[model samples]
Target: MTPRDLLRSAGRNTFRRPLRAFLTIVAIAIGAFTFTVTSGLGTGINTYIDSQTRAVGASRTVQVTGTSVMSFLNERMEVYRDDMDTARGMDVGSGILGEEDLQRITSALGPDDEYSANRQVSALYYSHDGGQRYRFVYNGYWPGKTANLVAGDQLRDDTDQAQLIVPSYATRPLGFASAQDAVGRTVEIGVLGQDGEVRTVPGTVVGVQEKSLIGGNLPFGNQVLDDALQDASWAGSAEDDAQWYSSVLVTGEDPDRISRDVAAQGYATATAEQTVGDYKSIVNGILLLLNLLAGVAIVAAMFGIVNTLMMSIQERTRQIGMFRALGMGRRRVFSSVALEAALLGVIGSVVAVALGVLAGRLLGPMALDLAGLDLPGLELFAFDATSLVAIVLGVTVAALVAALPPALRAARMDPMDALRENR
Candidate 1:
């Protein structure tokens, strides 16, 4: 028979036992869909992580603060089993990485090395509309990046104390709806400075950023870009408030190599890739467990296909004997059974993929509610080209595996005995 005829025969036989075919298809679809969705989530996670790493503009970053006088690290180490545990119990003290220490670290670096320091402080925003408050605000501060500079100039070292670069959120009360319009205007920055004084500083907006990153060690909330020079001024003014040096950023193509070399210079380093990888691993582990559970549904469906095929073989004993007497090879008989299984797999995969795409679209908007996070660009289910290819491969593999035993049994039937018994 021609290949087209064989295919037609396969399709016809697949539905001979409709329930069994349906079950087999369901199994294949479940397996394929799980594989596709898990892989897609992993990809999205890694992409999101890398974007965060780039936002920091550093392959490696180190945070060195003053060692506390009370020997908290030592006390924690004595009480805890490991460095990680000790870190959890410890709090930073002065002299770890002050201006003088930063200068010293910079001096120690090779001529090729360059670094920048950032000041980190937490404060609550007082957003009031005639005594009606919407929400309390938390945000981060950054230096700048070449990618996201939408308007005006980036935070420069020579900026006066009165100038600031506020995040887009800061402009809500001022009647500006967009980040672009917020730049070049003035905003209020409130904080309890060093000493027992509460201070609110007014500064000019220098720039606006397009992307809002919320991953890695970079930042946890909305962010504003500020000049490094201004950071020093804030720290100096609020000495008692103690704005810690968040990071000393270092850049190089290969962060692992750069971090190791930097460590030898008496300064610690953490590669952005390494940090991001750790975060991805945590997310991947969760997805794996969830996908595995989804896969169980597919396994149950496969049993239905097997039962259907076995019944078909029994009912067609007389037909099988006739085909054998007509000189059809055992291999052809096996091919017929296997082809049916394959067709079922193909149909199931197609249906599942279409379903997955629809699910992603419907669930994308609910990402915020499900995840308890307002991820700006998140989709609950994403149907990507790579995922589609993976689904097809998974379905094909399942079909071949499920077909092998049944095909062999059907091919090995005793033709003469089957014909006599049928009569």
Candidate 2:
């Protein structure tokens, strides 16, 4: 028989036992549905991570934090008294990155490399029109990296001018009509001093930052503005110690080499790519576990395929003998049975892919809304062509393999024996 003829015959034979074939197809569909949806979830999350990594300037930049030896010790009594005494004796400059360390880092860099130091600020208070003050946390904005801005512009690192970037969500609370309206306006920021006094400083609102999963609550400012606030808090207090930075941001052409070099200087470094990679690994691991559970359903479906094919073979013993008595070869008979199994797989996969894609698109947003996560520019479902093709091929292969034993038994049967036994 021609391949086309064999395919036509196989398809007709598959549905001879309609209930059994339908049940087997349903079983395979369950597996395909699980795999496709889980893969979509992984793709969506990784895509979001990629976008966030770029938003935070992670592509060309690395965050460096001073390696503190005391952090390695536990807070319990297991920490020796001598260790505690030594930690106490270490100055603020010793434990964190100081001026000397910053200078060393800069000197080691090439002319193309740029760096920004993050200064710590405390007890920041802000108000619009000099009324109804609100306290907020602060984070130093690195001018070397691009900010994900919703309005206005990034803060200038070169200027000592008091400029601030307000969070997008804070615009309405700060009495602005919108994020754009908040830009080019003056807002008063006050630092609570050690002597119970609030020293107010007026800063121009140069930009408004979009809400982010990371660093959403805190407002950002340039080095000059951060320094002014820190200095104000330190004035009139015995805490007039040398300035120590919280962390440093560095940008270089070769991030791997820079990370190693930063580590050699007794500081820890994290790149944006590395951070995203770590998050992807975690997301992939969870998806893998869920896929495995779905695999269980596919395996059960395989057994169903095997049983259905075996029963069909038994009921068609005389028909098979008649075909062999004709010009039909054993290989053709095997091919026919295998093609039937493959057809069932194709049907199941088509149904599954349609359902899975629809579910992923609809349920993703609903899940996010239920969780109350207001992450802007996040898509929870993303589908790719490669993944869909893979799902179909995988399920088809599994179904064909399960039909193998039954096909072999039918193919090897003697025509006279099969006829006599059936009679």
Sequence-dependent TM-score of model 2? 0.84
Residue 225 deviation, candidate 1, in Å?
A: 8.9
lDDT of 1 at 134: 26
Q: What is the lDDT of candidate 2?
A: 0.77
RMSD of each: 6.6, 4.2
Clash list (residue pairs), candidate 2: none
Tens digits of per-residue lDDT, candidate 2, 146-235, equal: 557889998887787888888898898889999999998988888766555778877889999887665444677766777777666555
What are the models' TM-scores?
A: 0.72, 0.84
| Residue-level lDDT tens digits of model 1 in 268-371 | 45555555665667888898896786566556545655666667777777776677778777988888887877787778877887776666666656764776
List candidate 2 segments past 4 Å from native.
67-95, 99-111, 158-160, 192-198, 215-217, 233-243
The TM-score measured for candidate 1 stands at: 0.72
lDDT of each: 0.55, 0.77
- Candidate 1 lDDT: 0.55
lDDT of 2 at 294: 74
